[model samples]
Target: MNLEDSTALQFDTPYMVIDFNQSLKNMKKVQSFADQHGKTLRPHSKTHKIPLFSKRQISLGAVGVCVQKVSEAEVMFDGGVEDILISNEVVTGIKTDRIADLASRGCRIKVAVDSEVGMSSLNESAREVGKEIDVIIDVDLGMDRCGILPDDFPGFLKKSSGYSNLTVYGIMAYDGNVADESRSERSRKVASEVETLTKLCKDYERINGEPQTVSVGATSTYDLWAEYDIITELQPGTYVYYDRRTTEYGASTMDEIAMGVVGTVMSKTHSNHAVIDAGYKSTSIDNGRYPILIMPSGDTAPVTSMSEEHTVCSDANQLKIGDRVLLLPSHACTTTDQWDKAAIFGLNEKPGTIEIKGRGMRE
Candidate 1:
């Protein structure tokens, strides 16, 4: 049945829905932005966790897909995505073995490493499988997350030279800390980070040779990074289906957000508040921002509280029992992980189910 029709209301509640048309537009816009700036678009797959969406992104000119875990990369590889990058470090022996296995199976898999230990583990695992794995040095550009310091890149590069089973592909940095700042402030911060990265790349080339890739940026700093001459690739994941935080940070508007939770009003115990079937289990609260309730009257209400099975909304008195509400989640990444499947719909099309193939791939 056509999801745009009223019959869509009869399927089920508390399910994630994606407006395919909006999502396609978002993908195309980012692709065009990257193409115009001479940057490779390697969108992170952790946002949607759907291989079908990854294929869509690739078809729209994305160079490849970026994953956070070896298992997530395996999922994408199984789904026919050939080139995959584990954009985060994988230090565990089991995870490294999986990466080596993928390489032995003819998958072009590259991973990020921040330390000698991680490089050694990856090299040993690759050696055991009689294969070589490509790796990128993850530089900590003020995010203080999982990356080697800019000053420490030389030492790491020297250590990496000893690993014959590992090839140093390039460098990667994630500027996640500047996502919520104003565009001007974010550009300033990104410029500084880009300078550090550029110098590091030059220094590495001087010491050894030119690296293959220099990756950077998130959804917030994508446009800023596009203007730089140093960055070779862009890795912005959330632009596909922006969330409440994206809108709040001015990265995307609410109308551009393509994903939402369709829930049923289960109770109206108070005069000014009501309960819905979706709660923390359905939407993410990691950013301390709750989902916004899209009321039936084309208005909005604030989500006051949420438990495992209930979402309490303030000023939901206009909603009655069995009423439907569309909730825009706070963070699209975590919210996508909460569901195993999504109902994808578009104008003049039937709603179809797509498996969240990369879900629960925390390893």
Candidate 2:
């Protein structure tokens, strides 16, 4: 939904705007893709951080939602999300207790464990609460940031039997590192990884029982991941509000992007030089690319530099003071975190704002 009809600039500058219709379209398209491939869509909530969107995703045939932090789980559970998978490890005692507490209150909490200490902490907490917490062994799968290596997974699984208050939910093998600029190369890497993951799951199930869950996929490899039956669920989050990187990877087109930071030109030193009120303080460049600037006329504006609260563009395309423009972030996940609420555009009537329910839930 674009504000094309001169009725769009009623709001203040430097607002995080969401195209409601486009966001819904993006969600539906991905959900349909997952359904066609017979995979459960458990979108990662870290992208939007709003429980309303999470519930909306669930309503559109998603099984539940995935979050990376215990605090994010708490926020979603409080927002009436019953099933949540904390797709990251919780090694701290307090955070583990929070997870156990949520479980004791009847929220289905599943967490990923990659080390003995994390599992032990979760086990102790769940034991105190007397609740059975589902645990998914995180397999490294070349990420190297977390998870146990594939060769040591069996030993890790063997060791987990001692934890009485925990159940092996399955495995979370995210091929996040399988990203390549070439679509064919990316597809090949994902297929190879999926094949290996499938063999591990099948071999383990042949001896033991079937793993309760097999969660994987990121937006970069979501389409390729859906082609395989090795996994039971998909965990792509950025599909909700694809950013510039999504376009660069060919996972999304420019029009499919549903998020942007709207900023007004506050100062124009020259016709080609203008300062936008939005900068790193409003959006982010963590993905190592400047936010793509678009004028009201839909022409691209080349950004020169971004400081705390101002973005200087060398080629403003004849934009002047008081003119409003949109800047699309390269990394939607990090950019979304900068705002507390989003000014919703493309609605039927006046714009409305929704709180970022899980914003700043880093703990």
Candidate 3:
């Protein structure tokens, strides 16, 4: 049989591989932590972008999945994800209408808004669908990315309050600014933001006469943020597949690092230097974080540089010709998006596969 047709054939350079056991463990552990803390776990599906992963997440007690785009939401809806939150700003027109259609199909849809345009678009779509859509006012806690200023939150909320067709649920303050390197510092910074934002949630309730659901923090600081007295929901995407940068976040141990790209060492040029078939195309090169290499002996190293079809590892002296290496990416989401599907590997059973159905479903 040809290599492509052969089940045991050597894969050409540059393919993505995911360890099923590691990925599942990451999902289970995070969900369990959320359950223990009484916070609803709504993982960002933008990480996996796979319906199978979404199904597994829901089965593990995730309240719902959070998606960044309408296209992603549509994919999740078809994948049997009954609930979704479009966590980013979705403008009016076709996309907003798409959101309405998904809701019409029995998918519970909630969206985040920060500007008058965003609120108007969401409200317009909701009214057209003749449904009361749940809305979360995204607050600019610190990221300065895309959220209404804290001082302007009330005015922003006022715009949506009167719309019976649009239910102002709460606020989503994503503290993506906090660096996870120093645990104490991460907790301190995240707590400060959470304190200020939770107060805003309380203040919103004071004015609106209803409790607000304040969602905050991320996977790196989920442990600290979840324990806080305020947050109602937790959105941690990378926790589904702990990556190199995240492992350094002190969020998970090496044993907990569950995702890697399996590649064969194509050349052993010299001592302590080997070239792997997987490269920048197969794995992500974020520049800020390093790619980890797991040797066949179960030991691991780091890739010094990554090109299109080649990854150079200076510490791979022990690695020999034809040895398969597993690479833990610097960024899990970006790296996983490079693949068409992930080969699920395990020790006992035949490797399974799942299509990355929405890999580039950016539309």
Candidate 4:
């Protein structure tokens, strides 16, 4: 059976591959969006985990890339990605030292902070290295995750400013909970978020001088939030390789998704179920969602469940052993972390392998 990405079909089973052309298109589209809005594009690289992909984002006009951990920042820098923002908290001394070392070596590293401990440690590290580190105040718009709450942010910012080695230049207000599915509702919720972010930026400015940047948005709400002028940087991750979850959120179409796991059918033990050679270890089962299966015949199959090494399709009667299938992710970011390399094709140039340089770099 012939498929559109015939270049990837010949690869061994249970590997990740991307339609390079689609990936580039996605990059260019988002870059154009940022450029037209006068916003700086700093895509979060935690989705792809590959430094090469982060560099490609920079090449496509992204000001820089955002990473979640110090190791990812180091990987990006080592792989020739010049600028990085560790858009998450890093409080440990070892990690903070690593980040300071990167900044001292001219990596142009910045980090997001929600607590004074993060501030103290990073500042101390930068002091030891005799360098300054840019920091973004991470505020919780509603995600209830790592950011400081809106009510306590002014107090926190007052406490967060004593670090002479750290400069608070931006605000990282992630509205991950603003996903309402409806476009109008999404826009309304994002407008509320923008209002809150604008207030937070003013608070930051009042205490810490001028807030140079206001970073926000995910792939689901990037377009909606881009309409606002207060947002200066976009941190959308999954837009690089949108998945089933992104499609479910109306952020992208199934045809526009560029990444998938190529797995070969290994068993059809039951009449109604077919087991593929990939599972949660190969793809990702994040958010309790399984990958969507695409059979060799170019038809879609429903993935019922996945374990460590096997993905089972409960309604896969048309599939058989030896057939190759593409497993499109439900959540692209976590799914991308499962692989160490990707075979990219369809760029109109030579199809080749790209090392997933930041894969498994959780530190």
Top candidate when judged by lDDT against the true structure: 1
**CA lDDT for candidate 3:** 0.79
Q: List the lowest-lDDT window of 10 residues for candidate 4.
A: 1-10
Candidate 2: pairs in clash: none
Each candidate's lDDT (Cα)?
0.87, 0.87, 0.79, 0.85
Cα TM-score of candidate 1: 0.96
**Residue-by-residue lDDT tens digits, candidate 4, 141-223:** 87889899888989998887778998878788777776646878889888888888888878887888777898998888888
How close to the true structure is residue 209 of candidate 3, measured as C-alpha lDDT? 61
Tens-digit lDDT track for model 1 on 1-363? Answer: 112332254458889888878889999999999999999999999999888889899999998899998889999999999899999988888989999999988889999988777888899999999998889889999998889888888888888777999888788999999988988999899888878988898878976698789998899998999999888999999999999999999999888889888888999878988999999999999999899888776678888889998999887768898888888899999999999988877733666777898999988
TM-score of each: 0.96, 0.96, 0.92, 0.95
Of the two candidates 1 and 3, the one with more favorable lDDT, higher being better, is 1
Give the better candidate number (2 or 4) by TM-score: 2
Deviating ranges (above 4 Å) for candidate 3: 1-13, 270-272, 346-349
Decoy 2 TM-score against native: 0.96
What are the RMSDs of all candidates, in order?
Answer: 2.0, 1.6, 3.7, 1.9
Poorly placed runs, candidate 2 (over 4 Å): 1-9, 346-348
- Give residue 193's error in model 1 in angstroms: 0.7
Report the Cα lDDT for candidate 1. 0.87
What is the per-residue lDDT of model 2 for residues 1-363, given as tens digits with 9 covering 90 to 100? 364522274678888889888999999999999999999999999999988889999999999999999999999999999899999989999999999999999999999998889989999999998899989888887778888788887888878766889888788987777654579998888877887788779756864578877889999888888887677889999989898888988899988889898999999877679999999989988877889888888888899899999999997757989888889898899998999988886555876887888989989
**Clashes (N, CA, C under 3 Å) per candidate:** 0, 0, 0, 0
